[model samples]
Target: MPEYQIFKNIQKHISLSDSERQLFISLVVEKDIAKKEIVLEQGSISRKLYFVEFGSLRAFNVNEEGRESTIMFAVQDWWITDMNSFINQKPALLSIETLEVSRLIEFDFSTLEELYKRLPKFERFFRIIFQNAYIREQLRVLDKISFTTEQQYTRFVEKYPQIVQKVTQKQIASYLGVTPEFLSAVKKK
Candidate 1:
């Protein structure tokens, strides 16, 4: 596809031999999904990890009150999945939904295991990615505990301008752990 270059951009981070790359490409399944579609619903087994080729998606959970709380957003070049569920073959605690019409390359459990077995480097590649993800999650948790609402918004805006520009204010508020009304108030200031 015309977007091969963008996918290659991610491959550049971890060197893969020509044969391994060919095999990896063969194992991926490409999908095009509509905006607002739920690719992984809470309570369903999550067996795949998706790499975004275009557009965006959100991972979120519903509270007892039925309010949605966003955990993360994945855009082009990013990966999205319920990690625990995908790794353990358990029902997901989070739901993954597209925020825009999106193209994705997905790897299921069997293919991922085979990739690791066939190419040991593949294991290192994902290990690094997961380590970075874990560190980022740690920082976000610290921010949620220590930063003021306005400060959280500032950090978010500074770090993810693309998301701020494209996502709805309501969803942003939810992700920032604030109410829509409060977000509006913050914006006015």
Candidate 2:
């Protein structure tokens, strides 16, 4: 697929001029990530913002006991990054890893800042994306706090049907705050 398709999808949500589009495209660097590769590690600065061109990635945090808790997952056309590290230039609390062989379009922090200056409209596009992500995170938190495992699994399936097919049951269980066995039970019901 053309890189322009990604820009065009984003354009549907936020208008951009021809020059701005070209500039944005120029700032992005394409990369191929191997399955299970770590994109960002905890306690390291997240210098890049990634737009998935193909395949899936997951972000998670390790607990004191070394258990991983899934925070977010990004598939094709989704963006993934540790916002705190990217925006504040601080150490990241989360880690991002590819779940499968993936292609990504990435922009470093400096490049993004330059793009922001060259095209202010890009900020609006990012703001909308961030707002939607925030809302989804808030809902996920609420669901984990208030809903049963089955309910969480159901909601997850309804919200991201593609994820059910693409991601492992264990990963999906982690995202839903359930055990893989419990997820199987929920599915059976």
Candidate 3:
């Protein structure tokens, strides 16, 4: 599918004029990354916002023991990036890497800023997106604190059936704040 279609799908809830759509398209660059390739690494400034066109990507943070804790995953039609670094222009605490060979539409912060200035309507579109993301993250956090491993696994499967098959067990375990062995046990029961 074309990058424009991905943008259009995301823009479905927003009102955009032809000129604004063109302007938004002009700001993004399409690129492909191979599986296991790092799109954004920890300690680096995250310069771009990525819209996943195909395949999957994982965002994770490493602890003192160098164990990776998955923060989020993005698959086709989803968006992925280090929000903190992208917004603050500071070094990223998270690393984003492709789990499968992927195509992405990337928008740099400067270009995004320019688009916001040139087409103020786009600000509303992005605000809605950000708000939705924030709410989802909050819900995920609440689930993590309130639910058991089995409950989380059930909820995850219910929420993202596609992801359970596409993502590896270890990645899924990390996302659920569990060890791979525990995830396997949960699955067996």
Alpha-carbon shift of residue 28 in model 2 (angstroms): 1.5
- The residue ranges of model 1 lying beyond 4 angstroms of the native Cα positions read 1-6
Q: Give model 3's clash tally.
A: 0
Q: How well is each residue in 116-175 modelled by candidate 3, as lDDT tens digits? A: 898887788788888889999999999989998999999999999978888889999999
Please, what is the TM-score per model? 0.94, 0.92, 0.94
| lDDT against true structure, model 1 | 0.88
Off by over 4 Å in 2: 1-3
Per-model CA lDDT versus the true structure: 0.88, 0.86, 0.88
Better of 2 and 3 by TM-score: 3
Every model: Cα RMSD to truth = 1.5, 1.7, 1.6
Instruction: Give the clash count for each candidate.
Output: 0, 0, 0
- For residues 76-167, write the lDDT of model 1, one tens digit per residue: 88889999999999989999999999998999999989989988787888887788899999999999999888889989999999888779
Indicate whether candidate 1 or candidate 2 has the larger TM-score: 1
